[model samples]
Target: AQTVTQSQPEMSVQEAETVTLSCTYDTSESDYYLFWYKQPPSRQMILVIRQEAYKQQNATENRFSVNFQKAAKSFSLKISDSQLGDAAMYFCAYKTILAGGGADGLTFGKGTHLIIQP
Candidate 1:
């Protein structure tokens, strides 16, 4: 089984600034995918970025990036130039990579509420 932990229950950042959300995980699987998801007021889970465990490079998408420390089992999301639209609940999740190009169910963290101050 895999588990994810978000140490920060909430974080605040001024608009146009940057904020990083911390996440750590415990897993026995050797191969998997780490992900960051954002759920806004509309209650839709949006994929921010993803990092493959086998890849050494961190994943980045536009203003969203991740600091992935494989050995440390830490995956943190860094949001640059934060906007009001960024305000939402951020969740750290992971899924084990299975054989035959299959993957297991996703396990998510408790989530960190991100607040963007105008």
Candidate 2:
């Protein structure tokens, strides 16, 4: 089993600025994937970014990027140029890669409420 932890329960950032959300995980499996998901008021879980444990390079998507430290088991999300649309509940999640290219159910953190101040 895997577990993810978000130290911050909530974070605030000014519009057009940058904010980094911290996350850490514990797992005994060697093959797995880390992810950052954003859930808006609509209750839709949006994929923000993902990092494979086998990959050394951090994952990035537009203004969203991750600082992945495999050894330290840290995967944090950096939201650059934060916008009102970015305001949501950000969750850190992970799932172990199973044989036959299958994956287990995602394990998510408590989540951090991101507030984009205008």
Candidate 3:
């Protein structure tokens, strides 16, 4: 079973600063996937970024980057030049199996509430 963990329950960043959210996972499989998702007050889960376990290089987006440590099973998300729009619930998610093949949806962490200061 693969499980994702987000250590910080809450975090805050200034309007134009940067913030990194910590995440770790436990997986026995060498080839799997990790993802970062953002859920706003609207409760919509949006994909922030994704990383394939086999890839040694990290994954990054416009304002997001990941520190993927395959050996340590850690994946952290860094939000740079943060904006008020980035203030939301950030979740670390892992894609794994279940009893059947329907578990491809996602297994998410408790989530970190990101607050942005004006």
Candidate 4:
């Protein structure tokens, strides 16, 4: 089975500094999607951003973005102008892109602990 890997267990950024979280995955399937989800102290898995396997352009959402290297199977998240609210546990997730994909369970990494410097 394909699996997501988060090499960095923890990361800290200044209130206005930018931080990048590392994420890597191994999958044989060609059609799939990669996602970055944030789990705050409340434990809600908020979808921060995502990328499609076929898209050449990286996915971005407001201050969040992804550096997706399809050939290397790497999908890292970059947060710009970090803030206290950005402190949380971030997870790397993967899922197939087709019918019944939802039926198959989603794969997630252990998650990276993000800290914000006041």
Span of 10 residues, lowest total lDDT, candidate 4: 97-106
Write one digit per residue (lDDT tens) for candidate 3, span 22-77. Answer: 99989787777899999999878899999998889999999899999999888999
Q: What lDDT does candidate 1 reach at residue 49?
A: 94
- Candidate 1 residue lDDT tens string, 1-118: 7899999999999999999999999988778899999999878899889999999988889999999998899999999999999999999999998888665788999999999999
Model 4 regions lying over 4 Å from their true place: 100-102
lDDT of each: 0.94, 0.94, 0.89, 0.92
Q: Per-residue CA lDDT of candidate 2, range 7-115, in tens?
A: 9999999999999999999999888999999999878898999999999888999999999998899999999999999999999999888888665889999999999
Candidates ranked by TM-score, best first? 2, 1, 4, 3
Candidate 2 regions off by >4 Å? Answer: 101-103
TM-score of each: 0.95, 0.95, 0.92, 0.94
Task: Tell me how many residue pairs clash in candidate 3.
Answer: 0
How does model 2 fare in lDDT? Answer: 0.94
